[model samples]
Target: MKNFNWTNIRLFLIVGVAVFLYSFSGIRNEGRKIKQAEVVFVDNENFITKKDVNKLLKQNFDTVTGIKKVQLDLNKVEKSIDTNPMVDKAEVYATIDGKLTAIVVQKKPVARIFSGSKSYYLDYKGNEMPLSESETARVPLVSGSIDRTDKKRLSELLNYIYDDDFLKKNITGLAVMPWGDIMMDIRGYDFEVVFGKPINIDRKFKNYKAFLQDAIKDTLTENYKTINLKFTQQVVGTKK
Candidate 1:
C-alpha cells in the first residue's frame, strides 16, 4: 500500500512539472512574438493616439530599464487613457499577432463661454474646458451672472437654441441679469429680448417667434429697445 501511494505522488509531481513547462514555453513564445510584432491597427477615432500610448508605456516602464519585454496590461492602459477629460471612452486589446490596439472616443463640446476674465468651452455633459485662443469664433457668448445656478441655466438655454432653428441663427449674444434674467441680442433685427426668469421658457420663446413672424410679414417700422417675456402669457415691447 505504501508503494502504491508513493507511485501516485510521483505521477502527480510529473504531471504538474509537465504542465508548468508547457505554460512556461508558451509564455516565452508569446513574449518573443510580442517583441517582434509592430502596431497592426490604431483606431484613429479614439481620443488617445499611438504616441500617447507609447509615451505612457515609456514612463511606466522606466523602472525596468534594460528589459526588452513588451507585454502590456491592456485594461490598465485603457483605464489611464479614459481618465483624460476629453476622452469619452477607450478600449485596448492585443491582436493575434501580438500587436497592441487602442480604441478611443473623444467628448464633444456643445457651447463656449466667455466669463469672469476667462473664456472656456463646455461639452454636452456640461463639463468646462479651457478655450484655445487659436480656435475659430463659432460659439455664442454668455454674458451676465454666470455662477453655478446660471451655469445650469446656460446649459438649458443651449438646449433651446439647438431646438429652435430660427433662434439658433438669429441669436448672436446672451446677457444674464443680476436677478437671473436672460437678455438675448438677435442678429440683423436691431432688437433685444428681455427674457425675465427661466420659467415657462419654451412658451415665451414661441411667443417671441410668433411676434417676430408677424412683424416680418407686416413690414411695420416698430423700433424696439426691449421685448419683455417675463410673463410669457403677456408680451410687452418698449420702443427705442
Candidate 2:
C-alpha cells in the first residue's frame, strides 16, 4: 500500500509539472507578435475570398500581422467577419506559434430572389443574403411581387421542394403573384404549375406527384398548359 501511494504521488507530480509547463509556454506565446494571418473556410465555400477577410481584419485592427496575440480581441475579430453577408459564422483565434487564424463558414444559398431591380439570395435558414460578385449559387430563381413578409412562407415551400428529389430537379423558377399565389416553371415541360398560397403544402405536393405520375404514364403531360394544385385532394390540369 505504501509503494502504491508513492507511485500515485509521483505520477500526479509529473502530470502537474507538464501542465504547468504547457500553461507557461502558452502565456509566453500570447505576448509574441503575430507572424501570419490565415483565413480558413471550414466549408470550403469561398463566397467571400481570403483577401476580403484580410481586408476586414485590416479595418478592425489597422493591420493584423505584427500585432501581439495578447492584444487581439478574438470576439471583435469574429464579429467583424460574421457581419459579412457571405459568412455564416466565424471563429478567430491565435495559434501558439504566433499565427492568427480565422475559421469561417460561408452561408448556403437555397434560392435566389429577384424583386424589382434588386436581387439577393435566401440562405437555407431563410435569411436574406446579398448576392456575391465572387460566386454564384445555382438555386431556384424566384421572381414577381415577393416581399420580406412573404419570404418565410416561401422558404418553407422552397425547403419542401428541395427536400424532394423530383421537385428539386424539375422545378426551376417561381413567380409570386400580388394576390399571394405561387406559379412555378418546370423543367422539360410546357405546363406552368399554379402552386397557390403555400397552404396544405405537403398534401398539395402529394397530389401533384400523383397527377404527374399518371399524366406521364398516360401520355397526357403535353396536353396541359397549366397544372394547378390549388384545390385540395385533386390536381386540375388546363388543356393547352
On residues 64-84, what C-alpha lDDT tens digit does candidate 1 reach at each position? Answer: 223333456667777876676
Any residue pairs clashing in model 2, and if so which? none
CA deviation > 4 Å runs, candidate 1: 1-70, 97-101, 148-150
Tell me the tens digit of each residue's lDDT in model 2 across 98-183.
Answer: 78899889998878999888899988889999988888877889998886236678889988887788898899999988888999
**For residue 236, what is the lDDT in candidate 2?**
93
Q: Which candidate is the best by TM-score?
A: 2
Q: Model 2: how large is the Cα RMSD against the reference?
A: 3.5
TM-score of each: 0.65, 0.84
The global Cα lDDT (0 to 1) of model 1 is 0.65
